[model samples]
Target: MSGYEKTVLLTGATGFIGGRLLLRLLDQGIKVRCLVRSAKKFEAMFPGLDGVEVMEGDPARGSGLSEAMQGVEVAYYLIHSMGSARQKGRGFIEQDRKAAENFRIAGEKAGIERVIYLSGLGEHQKELSKHLSSRQEVGKILASGSIRTTELRAGVIIGSGGAGFEIIRYLVERLPLMIAPMWVNTRCQPIAVSNVMDYLLGCLTTPETAGRILEICGPEVLSYRELILCYANIRRLKRAILSVPVLTPKLSAYWVQLITPVPNGVVRPLIEGLKNEVVCRDNSIRELIPVELIPMKEAICTALTEVEKGPGGIPSRQSCFLHSLT
Candidate 1:
């Protein structure tokens, strides 16, 4: 990894995917500056981790970003929020818009060379939910800047700490007989978190990856019910799902929040997004950065194993799992 480039600015390093990416970047001997809301909190999480510079910043408010973005080569935008729905179920879209604008301005001023953003995958022609639209909008804003940007649009991510997997975990484990909404039949392509990590890490050294919009996903397309049953089969839990037309997305969100550790603010928006069939529209990423895409059953098994490890798991509880669908 010698002769590598200069420092890279990483946002959302405290979250599930970002935290893991932090570890990967450090392992590769990349110089990293993390833009976080709290320096103390970041240090507390990683303890004695070296080679990382922590700066306090809120991109939405444009605080501390001018300094954070200064002299950085590339940046990772992983700051998708489920908590943004804290006010009247319509806050996240506006918050995301503002944050992207702020980041674009800061990066442009700082002369950042590139930005790699992970966005939600869905056809724009299909009336996208608020969640998916917000995700894509952020990508658009970031790319609108002078800095070249690579946006990887992903569907349902299958991992322990991810909202999509955790919701499925709780639902299948707790309910032997389940009552669900019609969205349960909606098909989605579920990619393993490991495969996601591979693609992300690959983007770092692959200069050709810059300024591209790559749609990433797993090998199989299955309904939400199939995902549930796959988890059940993996865990040896007997489960049954009856898809009724009655339960609205809001009701389903409440029911899920009651069972899983995921909050209602996050669950509501994620549930609304489930209605859209999310599969990779483009497969260009496979040739750009090749990695063995893990199967749904294996992804389920790995996630369960990580959860069994408690605080020492691969995706630590401290890392934010604020993914929209995955």
Candidate 2:
């Protein structure tokens, strides 16, 4: 590989967005080193892949991160603890802070040039949900170090297999008659998973994105209710969503836990985070990376296709698997 070619380190390579991003990078012939908690899981998720290195590490544990950063040019911090039990105690934030600090120190020692982070879209330094606030704080921590950082803030990503999309899918597929919280009216500008991948890959080629924060979203902005209605339309399902203002975040989270199989730990943060509008506040990323953003319906269709593919397939549609809401 040329010197200009980035030897990238990717955290959360086994995750939904990370998996897609990894495939894109590999297709581009970019060298990649993935930090995974389990080598077996990594191999199972990405079997028979070439031109990639899988290093054993858990970012939350500060383990194996140093080795993963060795000789890496760019590192993508994509790890989150929404699914973990520790999230109940708001431990994800501390874990993320530690991970960011560790990665920064390790990357600095390894001479890494840049760190690219995918974070949630929300107001910074405010009363944001623990999840969103932690994401924002992690970006700040990464930028404070010697390695310059690029933070891409985005709303719920509409892609197959991603948690947010799964929630949308479950609500639409399982609940023909839906009782939703008032947050359903909260606005969001969701980007298709493909467009997000495009922008992430664009970061690899564009040197200008380093040390900057880019807010990204699709061309259309819609309410969470509208998103669900649109998804229902794509699936050709007749759905009715009744938003009840009395459903507190806690109650909504419990409902999600019971109905969607999403654990309370995960559902709570997502529910709380939903209280804030997540539309794109800036268009700097578009100026930097020009790709035709796909429409929401097309994005939903693509995600659904991946979901229908099931395991051992190319995720033909985004995974719509709901966590056991039991």
**Would you give me the overall lDDT of model 1?**
0.84
* Alpha-carbon runs more than 4 Å astray in model 1: 84-90, 311-326
lDDT, candidate 2, 204-318, per-residue tens: 7788999999998998988999989988776667899998888899887887777675566677888899988888878989889999998887787777777676753332332
Q: List the candidate 2 regions with Cα displacement exceeding 4 Å.
A: 1-4, 85-90, 311-326
Q: Residue-wise lDDT of candidate 1 within 1-326, one digit each (tens)?
A: 62456888999988878888888888888888999887887988899998899999988778988999888878999997667432344487888898899999989998888999888988778899899999999999999968899999998898778878888877777789889999999999999998988888788778889989998999999999888887766666678999999999989888888888777777888899999999887898999998898877777767766886756343332232223114
Clashes of 1: 3
Q: Give the C-alpha miss distance for residue 185 in model 2, angstroms.
A: 0.7
TM-score of each: 0.92, 0.91
lDDT of each: 0.84, 0.82
